[model samples]
Target: MHWIKTLKYYLKSLGPGFIIASVVLGPGSITVSSRIGSEHGYAFLWVILLAAISMVIYTSMGSRFGVSNKDSILQSIAGNYGRWFSAVIGIAAFLAASSFQFGNNLGVGIAMEGITGVDERVWPLIFTPLAIVLLFWAKNLYKLLEKLMMVLVMVMIVAFFFNLVLTKPDVGEIAKGFVPSSFSFDSLDIIAALVGTTFVLHGALYQSYLAQKRGWKVGDIKKGLSDSYTGISLLALISVLIIITSASALYPNGITVNSAADMALQLEALFGSYAKVIFSIGLCSAAFSSLMVNAVMGGGLLADGLGLGSTMDEKMPKIFTTIALLMGMLIAVFFRGNIIYTLILAQASSILAVPLIAIGMFLILNNKKVMGKLKNNLWQNVLAVFGFLLISIMVYFMYGKIITYIQSLS
Candidate 1:
């Protein structure tokens, strides 16, 4: 009976990290890691490590604020910035995130078609309804779903590492990725995509909301922190693994892969056409899981903005799910012509948001009035400021490239 109790307790402790990992494993991660592998080989693996450390710091702040104070970072921000400013941020985030989800969903579908040789256009039609159903199935039921995604993560790890071991990637070159090197136009973009990912708001926001949803209390702070750290660590490991697998197989071959599907095709050479099958299995899990999280986050944000947090009913989840799914599909259908634009928006959202969110949290955490004795110490402040600085630099450089690219086209 004691053993059973322990097992149940451990299982319950797993949710927060599972949620964070699910969002982190989505399209941005898949493509960026694959590109890093194909372009720089194992040389970019360290970027994921650095980015993971940043995400750990980022998610921890969200988890701490919610569990300790029983209020969200957004709520704190609203109090500081005024309700109107907070409302504007929410609206902009919703539109931007919705647009980004479209790209993520379409990327998943395209990868599925590439793996299965089916029509890409038809894939979204099938997935749209499925995604909606999964999102609203039950808030409590996400535990089981999280467990399933954990299994999927394991499978992906095995599939990737197995191939990586067979190739015997150069450890020496992989180590070189950690040391800062001269940046070129291409290297800067890949680094931006790598580190820019840490700034994305969805994963951290999910951490905040999930901590609140789980009834985690001030007493649960240590547990919440441990769970969040685990999740972010797993996410970081997956990020590094994706880069290592891609770099080992694609870079030496001089192969160029511009999309997830292209990466899948290239992986076929390493793991066989069955690599596509494995990738789709992973992609579907990633896409649907992230979709469910975004649906919940967006809907909750909408409800919170309207002061209707408690008014959300059983139907609210389903309605929000439908809204998100439809919005994503519409973007897929209408904006299919410009993949670059969609990709830029998806990556840029996080890059632009991270610094602001970081600054806000630093203020909130250090407020001796708000946190009292629980405020961040000097080391935490230093790390947070450094992370903010790193993300700001990446954003500045990436924005330049985007402008240059646009000018060339004009």
Candidate 2:
């Protein structure tokens, strides 16, 4: 009975972290990791490890900020910096989320088409209304979302792990891939996208808002940290599994994956039809989870910025979230060309907001007036400085790639 109670308590504590995990493992993750494995054959696997570590550090900071202060992150920024700064962050985050939503909706469509043999474009029409109903009518929106995301995470884990086992990747090469073997300029764009998607600005900032929604106090700081670690660890593990499955099944056969569907086709060739179906199931879970949460993040932040309420129960946030969902579905249904390029472009555009958000988070967390005793220590500050520099470098590379892509188009 004691063990059962403990298990229930632990599951209750996992709400925010698992939601973050679900958001991180979107269709963007599948596309990037699959392409990395198929094109570079696990040589770039180290990037996921780096991204995971960076995510843990920043997410922990966000968790601490949530527990240590009563104000929302944007409110804190407004108090410290100006309201304009807060508004900019909020608007930028909303726009970035909107841009990524195109891919999320596209992912949902692709998964549905693959699994049901229906037209890919029809999925956006079906799922968008379903998502809206859940967002509006779910009595306890946060708990309902947490529960739904938890189930999806489990589905993705089991499906990917099953496929990973079937792939039977070379254990020795997998071990070696962990080491930073070599770097390729061609891989830089995907690397940035991986980092951008994994260590998401909105996702990290929303950690504070989520913790508050869960009613976590400063006393729960340790628990919040544990939850963050657990979520990010799962994210890294699932990502590695994806790369392993793709590397083993596609690389050896010279299969080039241009989309998630391409990856599914390649997996079918290697492990028969069941593998493709399972992978598509995983893809659907990822896409749907992200589609829901991405809209919430965009709409919630924009409402908060506009001096309306930030929580999902508020009128403005719900309206804006619905708008985001519809916008994404429209794009996914109508704009059918060069989605991979669009995904990369949207992911890259998000880098413009990262440094600003990261720097703001660092400043707010370190503000003794805000965090008081919970303010970052010297080592934390050092690591955050390092993270800022890392984001700067990524931004440079991402800008170069976008320009190169544009020149090619012209």
Candidate 3:
């Protein structure tokens, strides 16, 4: 009976982390993981392991910050630094959210199009408005978003795990992937993609808000850690499954995965039709779940940064969230130019904002006055410095590629 009560408490405390898992593992992430699996085989599985460790460390920081402070992340920035500091974080978040929102819009539409035989372009028209309606319709936005993300996370696990079981990935090769000697500069670009997609500090920043939204307090740290671990582990596990599935099914055949859809089509060619449907189910879940939460994170941050209001039911947050959805939908529907390039640019800009956000978060968590008893431990501080250096290296690596890509276009 006591164990059952403990289980109920754990279940009740399980919202923010699951949201982090679902929102971070969006279509773009799936595509990146697929490409890594197909091109590099299991050799780079260590990257996901590295990313999961880094994310768990950072998200733990975010969760503590959420419980330790009554203010939003941005509001805390304003108090300690100034309004200008918070504003910078807010605007950057909104721009990045709005930009990547295009992909989510296109993603949901694409997943539907793949299944329903409708043009992907037409599907966003129907779905984006529904997202807006969902924003307005929710009496308590956090509860709704949490429940929705849970279902999506379960969908991804089931759909991708089913395919993974089918692949029968080489147990020995997969084991070798965990050895760091397998890493190489040749795969540095995809390595950055994996890290950027997984060690998403922006999502970490949002974790604080989600915790507070759950009505968490300083005493809830144990439960918060539980949720964080569960969420991050699921994220790493699902990503590994996607990569493993591709490595087994496509890497040996030398099929390059250009998209999530590419992985599905190629899987079907090898494993028959069920592969496509199963993979597509995972894709749809990823896209739709990300579609809603992207706006919530972006708009909520923007409003708080601007000193408008971070609460979703508030007028400003809703307006900003709706704008994010519309921005993505219009670009997804009306853009006649190169789609992938646009997504890359959007994501790149967002990645650029992460260092500032991460540094600010670290400072807050370390502040004795701010965190009190929760201030940074020796291990957390060590990881923060190390993570910073790693991110600096990645940014340099990614920036060079973006420059070369643009130069090629010119």
Candidate 4:
């Protein structure tokens, strides 16, 4: 009975983690994971494990920051590190979120288009306004977003798991994939994608805000840790499932999908028409969830960065949120391209602000004054540094690619 009570308490402490999980497990995650699995056949499963550890480390830092400080993260940073640095993080996060916002809008439309043949462009026009309405009109925006993410994350779990089940993967091969086989330089692109998608600093940074919204305190760190584990575990499980499903279903036949929606549509040839529908439903869930939450994160962080306000119930956060929402929709409608835009956005983020966002939480967590007794332990520090180095390497390769991409544009 006591154990049952403990489980219930942890369950009750679940909102914030779901938010992180839902945003990380977005359409981009699915597409990239699918590509890795389809082309490499689970050769890089170890990357997800490494990323999960990195994610857990930073997420815990964010959670600690949320509980240890009464002020928003940006506000705390301002006091300790100066407002200019905090503003950089805030602006970078907003731009990163805004850039990805384009893909999410198109993803929602594409997934719907795959199912109903409704013409992909039309869905974004409808969904974006609907997202704005909910973002502005919803009472207790934090709780609403939390519950919404929970539902969406579960939908993603069920949908992706369904696809995995259809693949009927080899458990032994999947296990062996975790043992990190040596690969060539050709694999760097996929490895980077897997890391970039999973070890996401932006989503981890938002964990602080989410924890604050949950009204967690010092006493609730245990629950916060539990929530972090649960969310990242869900994230890992979904990514692994997507990989195995694609590896089993497509790798053998050398069928690489251009989009996640394309993966669903192609599955129809192997399974049945309904397979595509189920996958599309999952894809739509991922996109719509990301479309709404990404804007909120961008808006709220940028608002607080500009010294407007932080809390969701406040006018400024919602106003900024609306701007992000509109920005994504407009970009998606105007450009109407998917793959190139996603790569550019991903690169832009890494180059612009992710390195700072990744390092900021570690600095804050380790500071004796700011974190006090909640300061990160030695193992956390070691892992955080390792994570930072990994990201630095990722950025190196990405910088070269960005240069080539830009030159091609001109």
**Candidate 1: TM-score?**
0.87
TM agreement with the true structure for every prediction: 0.87, 0.96, 0.95, 0.95
In terms of lDDT, the best-performing candidate is: 2
**Model 1 over residues 1-410: C-alpha lDDT tens digits?**
99999888876687778777875566656776776678777666666667777778767877877787766666766776666645554554454356457656777677667667787767777778776666555455455556766675566566556656655777888778766573566676677788754445546755766787778888888888988888887777767766777777788889866767777777777768777677666666666666656555666555554344522234554465478778877777566355644464466545654455556667777877667666788887887787778778886876676677668668
Error of 4 at 300 (Å): 1.2
Q: Rate the local accuracy (lDDT) of all candidates.
A: 0.67, 0.85, 0.83, 0.82
Residue 343 CA displacement from its true place in model 1, Å: 2.8
Error of 3 at 215 (Å): 1.0
Provide the global lDDT of candidate 4 against the true structure: 0.82
Candidate 2 least-lDDT 10 residues: 344-353
User: For each predicted model, how many residue pairs clash, with residues at least 3 apart or on different chains?
Assistant: 1, 0, 0, 0
Q: Give the per-residue lDDT of model 4 (tens digit) for 213-290.
A: 888999999989889988988988888989999999999999987777778877888989888888888889888888
Positional deviation of 365 in candidate 3, in angstroms? 0.7
